[model samples]
Target: MSTTGHHAAHKVVVIGGGYAGTLAANRLRTRPDIGVTLVNPRPEFVDRIRLHQFAAGTGQATADYGTLLGDGVRLVVDSAERIDTAARTVRLASGRALGYDYVVYAVGSTCAIPASVPGAAEFAVPIAELEPARRLRARLRELPPDAPITVVGGGLTGVETAAELAGQGRGVTLVCGHTLAPSLSAPGRRSLATWLSRHGVVVLEAAAVNEVRPDAVVFADGVVRASALTIWAAGFGVPRLAAASGLRTDALGRLLTDETLTSVDDDHVVAAGDAAAPSGRPLRMSCYAAGPLGARAADTVLSRIAGTAPAVIDLAFTGSCVSLGRRAGLRQFARKDDTATNVYFDGRMGAMYKELTCKVALWKIRREARRPGSMIWIKGGPRPGQPVADGARDDHGARDARC
Candidate 1:
């Protein structure tokens, strides 16, 4: 809609202003002829990577869109209700219809608390999203200093939350459904275990919660433990927008796309971030993947406009980092394919690395906003012609439960 002497030949509407959507919108600014509009439910950008810190009252987790998005991108503070791909229109929850030549589907994942677990939906507080983290913070404020806190799930979120609360002097217990920090190497897990033990955190590996009560959790093995507060960090689920919109999606509702990040059903609709399952093989859901995928999604759209063949997605992962608390952390390195490596960093060095990673994530988005096409990622992934193997998705679901 900018009339600054350049009329837009095409318009792009990016849904979900998370790391992916924001980057896609910013990257689209490289084409002045393409008007870009970003749709998000909230006005500010939520730094989801730090939601645990927000819940634990250790740090903040939001930034102004003014600082994160490019000037060429318009911000629409409304949720996308549906996408009519055939019509190339996005219907907003506010009842407005946004016509776009192309659309970027990046409506990230959410906390998944199964109702199958008795009372979990009612008693357990999930800290995956901003609102949930806010609720957890308020609830923590209401509890006494010696309140017994129970963190369920052995993933990164669970481990981090338990460590954070324990650092605050609360009696904490981490109930890992299986191995603790399952995504990390054995030594990394042992290091975390030692730290948790030294801080009086009772880590229950292989303990799955069968039920959550008002004051305790019942394990699958028939053990009942008192819990003043139960924090759920089990895993994440994507929005049902794609499936409801009639687009082809994977079992979990993530939009199915080709290696170029374009939806198989409609080339005009592309996907990125956690909501994207490319070639039926989704990379681990993490901010590390989100930004690069966002860049690729935008490039794909740009390529179509230019009548050029967009290159296949070439992305790699270096590792994953988890903050133990304000001053401690564990950084586990990974292969290009995203599997755990034996190399790990712990203690203050790890904490510093974790903080740097978070800062760098935001910095990358901002840098792209200032200079489109300036971003680059680790390459050397599977060749485009290769068939995706069975269970090809590199899953570190527990480590990136928030993604």
Candidate 2:
């Protein structure tokens, strides 16, 4: 065990090695005054947004996290079982305890499947993790060319999966509980609809699923028989780590965080990615939010350690990018707050844009992992206000008053 002393440096613990957690650890590693430790089950980072492409038999989507994390950041290859906030310790499944001065909770999220839905768990496959998506891809290759496939959920994942399957010359149908891409603006939605139609994808909006049979998906109004494969790409909820830690969280298990991404119930604990809820509003679960939010969490931690007041996390979603396949996609422009605007792009240009976005996201992770503690250069434009300096804030604010 490392000796504890009255040192000038503060220890920062980051859970999960996905986009948000990895970036947070990398950013914190840049500061010599901060001791950073990253805990995750996997040594490599998987680009989850491209899981659809992997499922459609494209290529492997894994990157080495060892080379990605900056120096001075300790990589703990284990799952975090629980976080003891009061004790400032994290319990790992490997039977080790990590003590930290600050904790960044970026445990990420999971694909939620309703237990009430019969046969759903037994038969349907979800692209929640990389292995499952890869398995689905292998399953697809084994099926007959004209086999019927049903994709549940009309959200971005479902749409992308259906489009990819259709492009692969399989008969595909999308079953959605509400309108397809419900979060998208009219122009983006229309563009997606046209693209799906062009690729021979049968979209059934407002269709509530009742049960899943061996070869069919039964809906409330009708039963879609002849389904050779079923893909569930529904909504996602955060892992239960926050609630299990006795921290304040939303109904979906997202940690309730203040404007600066610090946990409301414990200032020493901050959350980002799919596991973080920003005050009254719930940030959308996307890599776009996670990447920036991760950096903000690290900044908040670093500022607190340096006694500097952390800048408020200004989370503004500029737009949405959805890939239909390798060749087609939809780029929907939105306001700073993510309100969909009239601007839309389609066809190969949109696909290229989506690919570039993924590249940029990975690039940010790579850059931060190498340099650490540096401000992520926003490609579009500058954000208002001066960057918060490290160690300018009071230490008393790190404790939760209510506790």
Candidate 3:
């Protein structure tokens, strides 16, 4: 907070340092009159899209904040405990409070091993966030070379995790619960399915995990499969900070905001990333949407400070890509509203698309750090108050966000 001095005309505190939060903090620096302080639990920036690669010992998942955050943006290595909207203060985990003229609620998403499943809470390893991914990486290292590994969920993350392990010559079984890659078209799913089968991995589409034990996985139909290591890549969950702070949220605990990404309760509190439910129909939870939402949130605050009406959200989705392994992948083409189309890229071409997307996502964040407000996204998504078409809703229960 010291980077901008204590007496700046306006003060903004950004919660969470994910792609959205980091970009929002940097974008706010466009106005020197506005002082920005970012509050995050970790000191380094995490490339969440690479968490699966990290868990499989294929790639690193963190980047130095110095290389990502913009100048004059103070970084606070503390988690936000609560947001007292009435008092305009944010309570931190370290027993300190930060006052702000406005707050960006970009606290990102996470994955949890369900306690309802007997022993899953104890034996399963989740690879969606930093700590869980770290644990999975360490656990993989500790296991023998031929250990039986099971990946739950058939979404993009599940598909990627199973493939990465299988490519490394591990015995991997993917419990799809239902259909595999539900977001992809029939042909695209077939392409990915073919790649997985050819890599010596077992695909179980109808098997829903009923319970997880230290030595095996019990299916819903009472069949038992031996699994030495169970990697959980199931559904996602957002932090309860917004709900605990008494903000209006959708059913999934995403902050309920207007089309401009401003909170319904108060204009001083804006939201972005996976945590934001703009107009109650949130976009997919991916780095793709996070970057633009971050910039939009900053624009909303700047508009208020300048006494102008903020523009509504106008962002579109191209598609989602997932790596089959380091060598193969799939890119499912999507409509402007994010529904899957029949067109897609597969094999070596798909792998190139996946790698390029990852590199470009990071490059966009770094570009924003160097040039505030220079970030841009494709327009023509569903309008405010417009209903998202069938299959355009967030993929719950199975898939993590698309690539």
Model number with the top lDDT: 3
User: lDDT of candidate 2?
Assistant: 0.76
| Candidate 2 per-residue lDDT over residues 54-132, each given as its tens digit | 8888756678876677767777789998999889999998899989899999998777777888998888888767878
Q: How far does residue 171 in candidate 2 sit from its true spot (Å)?
A: 1.0
For every model shown, what is its TM-score relative to the native structure?
Answer: 0.95, 0.90, 0.96
Each candidate structure's count of clashing pairs: 0, 8, 0
Stretches off by above 4 angstroms in model 3 are: 389-403
**Clashing pairs in model 2, backbone N/Cα/C closer than 3 A:** 306-391, 307-391, 307-392, 307-393, 308-391, 308-392, 308-393, 309-393
Looking at model 3, report the run of 10 residues with the lowest lDDT sum: 392-401
- Candidates in descending lDDT order: 3, 1, 2
Better of 2 and 3 by TM-score: 3
Each candidate's lDDT (Cα)?
A: 0.85, 0.76, 0.86
